[model samples]
Target chain A: AQSVSQHNHHVILSEAASLELGCNYSYGGTVNLFWYVQYPGQHLQLLLKYFSGDPLVKGIKGFEAEFIKSKFSFNLRKPSVQWSDTAEYFCAVIPLSGNTGKLIFGQGTTLQVKP
Target chain B: SQTIHQWPATLVQPVGSPLSLECTVEGTSNPNLYWYRQAAGRGLQLLFYSVGIGQISSEVPQNLSASRPQDRQFILSSKKLLLSDSGFYLCAWRSGTTGNTIYFGEGSWLTVV
Candidate 1:
């Protein structure tokens, strides 16, 4: 079975700190990558997505993710994170081979940005 | 623009009681609907997905079941709820044309005591 892995379970950072959340997948075939954020008591929102082309993709709220096929990783990064950026982050993947629209999500990382 | 809505934002039920969570999508047709369970440290578990009306695919076999009676509506239900059924439920949909991204709803919180 295919799986998505987010190594970080919990992280704490002060405001304006650099942020990087690691994400990795099991499959090597063609895949779509996504980063989603869930604020406190809120639904999940798309942060960034990497389908094809340029390894690096930019998303809302000054967040980006780099899709490294060789490493089988699509890591989320932000130069400076704010308290508002504190949220649980989740990574998702959808395999395109004989696709049936089944999406797999990671365990999720809880980021606490201290003010 | 498209949006998904889930009902019973928060509910508390006793074990052995029936469960029904409804979801509806607006501004899209022939969309693929899905039901997910959000559990601690487990990420988003894909419970059921539908490509068309009355066509449902279940990922995990559990006490829960799903039904898609309409093209843009999906429902998750259980004949008898269990204590383990207490968790957050999310409804999502993706366009058959774009089919690449899935959007989630506000989610329903169910607590079985």
Candidate 2:
């Protein structure tokens, strides 16, 4: 079955710490990838998306992700993380071979940034 | 800007009770609507999707059904709720002409006791 995987389940970091979250998918052909974040008591929001341009995509709040097609991986990264950055992150993708707008999302990664 | 509204924000239902979660989208037309469930360890499951009015596709077989009565209104219903049905249900939409980036609504928390 098609799936998206996020290896990190829960992560803890102190303020100003660098962060990296790994995401991988088992899909072939062209695909659209996305990163979404959900703060406490808030709805999910789009952080970034990769269609067909550069391998590295920049998003709001200084977060970025690099898509490696050979490995089927799209890893999210941040140079520094603040306590406010504590949230749940999800990786999602939609294969474009016979695409409809359906997205397959990972189990999600919970980040806890301490002050 | 496009916006999606899903409600009621939270609900508690007993087993065997009926369930109905409604969603509507504004600022866009003829969009693709979807229903997804977020469980603790199951990640996000695509329950259903619709491309047009009265056109619904079931992605998973469960105790749930969906309907798109109008162009921008999608509804998820279950005749009898089960304990396993308790989870976060999110309503999402994607532009038919714009891109594949799907936007989500404030999810509804369902707790079936």
Candidate 3:
């Protein structure tokens, strides 16, 4: 079974502050990585995903993530965050095999953006 | 546009009571359905997943069970609810076609007192 670990549990930042959240997954085989965000009272939205080709993937809301195979890590980053960026972030992964598509998620990082 | 619907965005039930949460997806067929539980301040735990009707897979043996009656409908049921089951229950689906993006529902918050 694959597991995802997120470094930060909670983060507080003022408007316009740069942001980066660390994520590491334990999967030895081919894997697909994703970064999801859940705003207050909203469904989880895809921030970005890494399947193949181009280790760097860009997502909605000016979010991007880099997949490093050797390190088994896919970290989310943003050049500048705003107050609207406050949300709960989750890192998820699934094996590239076709048997099952179940996702293993990280503990999540709560980001509080203050104006 | 494709949409996923989950009933009773918030639920409150007493311990030992029965539980049933329904989820349906529109604009898709033969989709892969999944049931996940998220405890407060915790990660998502996969409870069940179904590749097709009458094909259910249990990720972890616990107090919850899931069923897929139709191609786009999935249900999570419990014979007796437990306090530990108090959390956010999410139903998600992915296209049967070759893709890795999974869409989550609005989520059902269940509170077992």
Evaluate every candidate with DockQ and list the scores. 0.66, 0.65, 0.73
- Cα lDDT tens digits, model 1, A1-105, are 889999999999999999999999999788889999999988799998988999999999999999999999999999999999989999999877764767888
Pitting candidate 2 against candidate 3, the one with the higher DockQ is 3
Displacement of residue A32 (Cα, Å) in model 1 is 1.4
Cα lDDT of model 3 by residue, A26-96, tens digit? 88888889999999888888999988999999999899999999999999999999999999999999876
lDDT of predicted model 2: 0.92
Query: Per-residue lDDT tens digits of candidate 3, residues B1-113?
Result: 67899988999999999999999999988988999998987778889988899899998989998889899999999999999999999999988655558999989999999
Which residue pairs in candidate 3 have backbone atoms (N, alpha carbon, C) closer than 3 angstroms, thus clashing? none
For model 2 chain A, the run of ten residues with the poorest summed lDDT? A94-103
Please rank every candidate by DockQ, starting with the best: 3, 1, 2
| Regions of candidate 3 where Cα sits further than 4 Å from its true position | none
Q: Give the TM-score of candidate 3.
A: 0.95
Residue-wise C-alpha lDDT for candidate 2, range B48-84, written one tens digit per residue: 9887899888988899999999999999999999999
Give Cα-based local distance difference scores for all models.
Answer: 0.91, 0.92, 0.91
Please name the candidate that would achieve the greatest lDDT relative to the true structure.
Answer: 2
- Per-model TM-score, in order, reads 0.95, 0.94, 0.95
Share of real contacts kept by model 1? 0.65
Per candidate, native contacts kept equal: 0.65, 0.62, 0.71
